[model samples]
Target: MKQKDLIAVFDNDRDLVKAIGTLKENNIPVKDVWTPFPVHDVLKMLGRESRLPYFSVAAGVGAVIVTFAFLYYTAVIDYPIRYGGKPYFAFPSFVVIIFLLTILLTFISTVIVFQVRTGLFPGKEAEVPVTGTTDDKFVISVGSKEGLADEIITEAQVILSANGAVEITEQER
Candidate 1:
């Protein structure tokens, strides 16, 4: 799907929130939001559900389990090295290795999952519709559907301006 639309920029979080509230009050549809650092309660203000933390937790747990299982299988079944008269299944001695491996694998998997989910990594270029939105500003972007988009942009701009936004820019993408 292609996003063809206009985006309205704001200077700060308060202005962004006010703009979003105004849009909601006016029953205007907003397609997306962009911000510099994450603003507290922004998702709730915009009626969005957070998913990244949940996904990251799931990936970390999966990584830990897989790493532990692989190490156990390899040490007890594949290699079965009995060093210094230690038992093949010496669980206590394996704790340190297992914990270390679990952390390592979890970190690696978390990074990989984040990169894949966000479409970022080597040989991948992210499509940023508004670059300034992530620097010192926020953006309210709406896709072109009908004349509704212009109305939304106009109302959003008014709200943002009233809420103390220092600058506003509109661009068709």
Candidate 2:
């Protein structure tokens, strides 16, 4: 089933934090937060683990393993070719190929993983819940549930305004 969502925009990290704190303090459920650049203490404010770095590490490891395996299989088993008196399974020479392959694989894999995880990819229309959120602004989104969207939107508007937010707007989808 398609899920409905609400997006609320804020002007800065300070206001964003205050809005989030108020929501949590009042037992509101925030689905996610979006910002263009890193915000100090934002994760702590939201009580969220940093998943992007973990995903990057995993992608790097996978890239290394895949590069090593492909080079190993091609050089030692599939079609061994000796050159310059070096052994068919020359480990030193393989280093260059492995390193290059690892870098390429890592970059591509990381981008793909990030896109999938964040629902951002080519051909997908960009969703800027709040235009300013990507430029010195912050956004908080709450999933729409039965009989709760209006309440959440209202509370968010009030909390954001009270916290010095320059502007607040509710977006429905």
Candidate 3:
């Protein structure tokens, strides 16, 4: 299925953010934003939040608990050891390994989650919506669906130009 999109290109992040705000104020839906670098303000304005941090935290905690449990079971129940009058379940010794394993598991889980969520895998090419987006340009795209009114597009273009869009073009995808 082919879709029509109105793209507003900005030379800087400030203009892009400002244009997005204006479009929001006018109730124009912004489909996506492309920038050379991560724009925290733009992500907030778009209400885009990542679950990676949350998943990492959970993974770390789970790793710690599981690591501790496995150590305890092996040392105390599975194989009892009495060396140098030390206790079978030595918590002090477990600390270092537990911390290391937690970091390792958390990192692995975070990477896996990120890759899965982003659809990034081997032999897959990324889709670039507009040119110069990965350079210094910022792009704001508004999607046009079936029965979309031309008046809305015109209004959006007016808003984009007024808010410092360097160029506004229509593209079919």
Candidate 4:
């Protein structure tokens, strides 16, 4: 089922935030939000806690474990060498390589995850983006046509307008 994105435009940040609160209170899930600048209260109202940080930590840990296993197997068993009084399993020398690999992998993985989750991947065009959302206006985008009834959309528009949405536009995703 294809989904549609509905954009509700507000003339000011206050109105946008109020509309967001109204939608949430009424159980109309906000799909996305856009503003000229950061608005902590608006995000708080949305209540969507990000899982990106947790994902980064997990990826970092996984990278470290894999790097350790690789280094350990190679240095301690596969090709053991006693050089300059250092034993076959010299933990000190492996630290630099492990640290570098972990950092690199974590960075790469985090970027991939961010792009995938945010729909910012290369070649993917914007779906129902509202121009000037980065300048004079604030926007609250809602709607995913799949199972989103017309009555619900109508209700959402009414709620948004009642709360101060100046304009509402519907577009396909």
TM-scores of the candidates are 0.75, 0.72, 0.93, 0.73
* lDDT for each candidate structure: 0.71, 0.74, 0.88, 0.85
Candidate 2 similarity to native, TM-score = 0.72
Ranking by lDDT, best first? 3, 4, 2, 1
Q: lDDT tens string, model 3, 109-170? A: 89998999999998997677766999889999987456235788899999999999988998
| Residue-pair clashes per candidate | 0, 0, 0, 0
For residues 1-173, what per-residue lDDT tens digits would candidate 2 score against the true structure? 34456566777677787777887887777777889887756688777756777777787788778878898899899999887998988899878887887788778877777788778867997677767766877888865455355666677667657777665554444
Pairs that collide, model 4: none
> Which clashing pairs does model 2 show?
none
Error of 1 at 147 (Å): 5.8
Candidate 4 per-residue lDDT, tens place, 27-126, comes to 8878888888888897678766678899999999999999999999998889988899999888999999999999999999999999989879778865
Task: Flag regions of model 1 displaced more than 4 Å.
Answer: 1-6, 47-50, 123-131, 143-153
Candidate 3: lDDT of 39? 93
The positional error of residue 74 in candidate 3, measured at the CA in angstroms, is: 1.6
Query: Which segments of candidate 2 are over 4 A away from where they belong?
Result: 1-8, 43-52, 142-144, 149-158, 169-173
Worst 10 residues of 4 by lDDT: 143-152
Root mean square deviation (Cα) for candidate 4: 3.8
Off by over 4 Å in 3: 1-3, 144-147
